[model samples]
Target chain A: MNAVKAIFLKELRVEFRNKQMINSYLILSLMIIASFRFAFSIIDFSITELASPILWISFFFGGMFSLSPIYKREIEQGTKEGLLLTPISPSSIYFGKLFANLFIIFCLELFILLLFFVFFPVNIPDLFSLLCIIVISTIGITALGNLISAISSNLSQSEVMLPVLLVPVLLFTVIMSSVSVTSNVFAGANIFDVLDEVRLILAFDVVFIAVGYLLIDYILEE
Target chain B: MLKNKLRILVSILAIIFILISVYFALIYTPPHEIMGDVQRIFYFHVASAWISYLAFGVTFFAGVMYLKSKDFKWDNIAFSSAEIGILFCTLGIITGSLWARPIWGVFWRWEDIKLFITFVLWLIFIAYLALRANAKSRTSKANLSAVFGIIGLICIPFSFGANRIWQQYHPTILVSSEGSLQPSMALSLIISVIAFTFLYIYILLVRVDIEKMKEEIDKLKQKVGG
Candidate 1:
């Protein structure tokens, strides 16, 4: 627990200390959300109906931006050896990074959601359900993102490789369930109506987190 | 020498079965009652789909074994299987599209779960192959491919079950709720699958041998440089 907290706090401290990553995520997400505004005219399509996909797309990009550097910086600075040399379990390292990425991504997601409400004529019919969906889906996204980022960080072309590796894996798992459920939430469906998607996202979150936790050792192998 | 002879035997057997299967599909089986002869594509389409799925399953298993055992041989098997799987998958999609253009009046159906899942599966493995190509060292390639391969395999079930979470067009008539395939059609399909499976094995053997030779060449060059 202390190791997770220390690592988590260290990750946050690093991000806040520099703020370059957060700024890039902010600009990228804002651009994505702003471009989406022009793509869907309110005259042709209802923004409320389209809000779910728009928000998730922005979140996906933001999540990717945040995830890409999870281990790259460690490798670049040679802190990877320092971290590995610590008397800590690898699962601790994974979960700590996972949580930090989750926190950063969830914040960006909420920011994007707020922008959607302001920039587009969209509504959250059920705010609680929407938040639940965002949190659960973001967990799933961050879990898989951490694993893929770890894998990509080892490669030379980490930037291009991250999304190419991530998008397909996310397509059927996190993106599908979250977009579907978020749409239902936007459409004012009862919570029970979106239970299946919620369950699917939750199952994915559990599976990927466990897989990432177990697989971190192999991925971190020298 | 014996291995070479066995490979020749398998290649010959595969060619013969493929010819026989084509004959059975085209001449022996009666055309569909409503769709007519275009339905003959079903035999090859379904068989290719099955083989592609089988090939990917082998890739996943071999990937796991490679990770567990750290054997480059298993990595070779995984890579060869994935390459063949992609080929058959492309063939399956093309054949399916051709059939759909005639019957469904479209080359692709957006709402079909199987179509969506299969496309995603293709993209996932393509990404896997891309990662393998990009990796620098032998261990890096094996480790990364194994991890991605496992993740790709996991994504498949979720992709297939995406329909369950929402309404999707599930037009799975090739194997219906009741096992209702005509015996003759089934026979033709079985022969195609066997022929393709043999073809997969033969190609895999050749590819692995080539990979081994390449590694040998790399070693010799390194020794000469040293």
Candidate 2:
């Protein structure tokens, strides 16, 4: 507990101190949401149709851009080696990175979601459920992305490679559930309607975290 | 070498089997009563789908074995199978989309959960291939990729079920039950599936051999230079 908390705090402090990734995430999220809003300024699709895809796409892509720096910075600074040798459980390192990533991505998505409603005036029928979807999907993405970033951090051109690797992982399962829940929530469906998707998102987060915990050791093997 | 003879034999057999299957498909099987001649593409489409699954199946098992054993040969097999799987998956998706254009009136349908999920699976494996490409060392590549392969296999169930769980209201594009198949269509489908399986094995054999040869050359280079 202490090790994971220490690592988590350390990563959080370092990230806030730099704020480079956080700023870029904000800009990218705004750009995606704003551009799509403009592109659809004429069509006028329902909030259920337009806002859901735009919201999820912006958040996923925005967080995707921010994700690589979680590990890429470590690899770049030669600090990943020091972190690995810290006598902490490897899974603690994985969870620490995952928690940090989940925090950044969740905040970025929340910003995009808020900006989305601000621009479009789309009413989310269930603000609480929408938040649940965002938080669940963010957990899933962060767990998967942190591991993928670790795998690709040692590779050249990790920024480009991260999305190529992360998008596919998200596409089939997590993104689908997130989009489903978001769509249903905006469509004014009853909460029961979105429960299945919520469960799916929850399950995916567990699976991703488990995969990371078991495999991070092998990935960091030197 | 003995392996050379075996390769030639498999290559010739694959060629002959594919020829016979095409002949049967074109000349032997009857056209659909409803969809007409565009239905002929079904023979190859279904076969390609199965072969793609077969390729990924090999990758999945080989990947698991590689992780357990730490043998590069298993990694080689996984890599070879994944390469073959992606090719066949592309073929399957293209063929399905082409079939969809005339029948479903759209080249792509969001409601068609099977094709959409297949496309997603296709995307995931493409990422798998990229991971394999980005690794600097053979062992690391094997290690990372094997983990991904396991995850991909786990996702298969959800991909198969995504449509049913998502919307009870959407249309299922393909309906195949036990009694839906006419005898001639069934025979033709089986023949083509067998032929495609042979082709898959032949291609994978060639790819694995090439990978092995590359490794041997690298080994020889290190021996001479180092």
Write candidate 1's Cα lDDT for B1-226 as tens digits: 9999989998998899899989999999988776788989988998888878888999999999998999999999999889988999999999999988878778997567777877887899899999998887899999999999999998777766565554522244342212246889889989988888888888988988888899899999999999
Q: Return the TM-score for candidate 2, rounded to 2 decimals.
A: 0.92
Whole-model lDDT per candidate: 0.85, 0.80
lDDT for B138 in candidate 1 is 91
Top candidate by lDDT: 1
Which run of 10 residues does model 2 chain A get worst, by summed lDDT?
A172-181
- Tell me candidate 2's interface RMSD: 2.1
**Per-residue lDDT for A1-222 in model 2, tens only?**
898888788888888888675687788788888898789888757766667778878877888777778878888898988987788878898888788777777777778878888887887677877776777778877888788888778666677788887776776667766666677778887557767667777788788888888878777876
DockQ of predicted model 1: 0.61
Candidate 1 segments whose C-alpha is farther than 4 A from its true place: B168-180
Give the Cα error of residue B71 in candidate 1, in Å.
0.7
Fnat (0 to 1) per candidate? 0.52, 0.45
Q: Candidate 2, after superposition: displacement of residue B124 in Å? A: 1.6
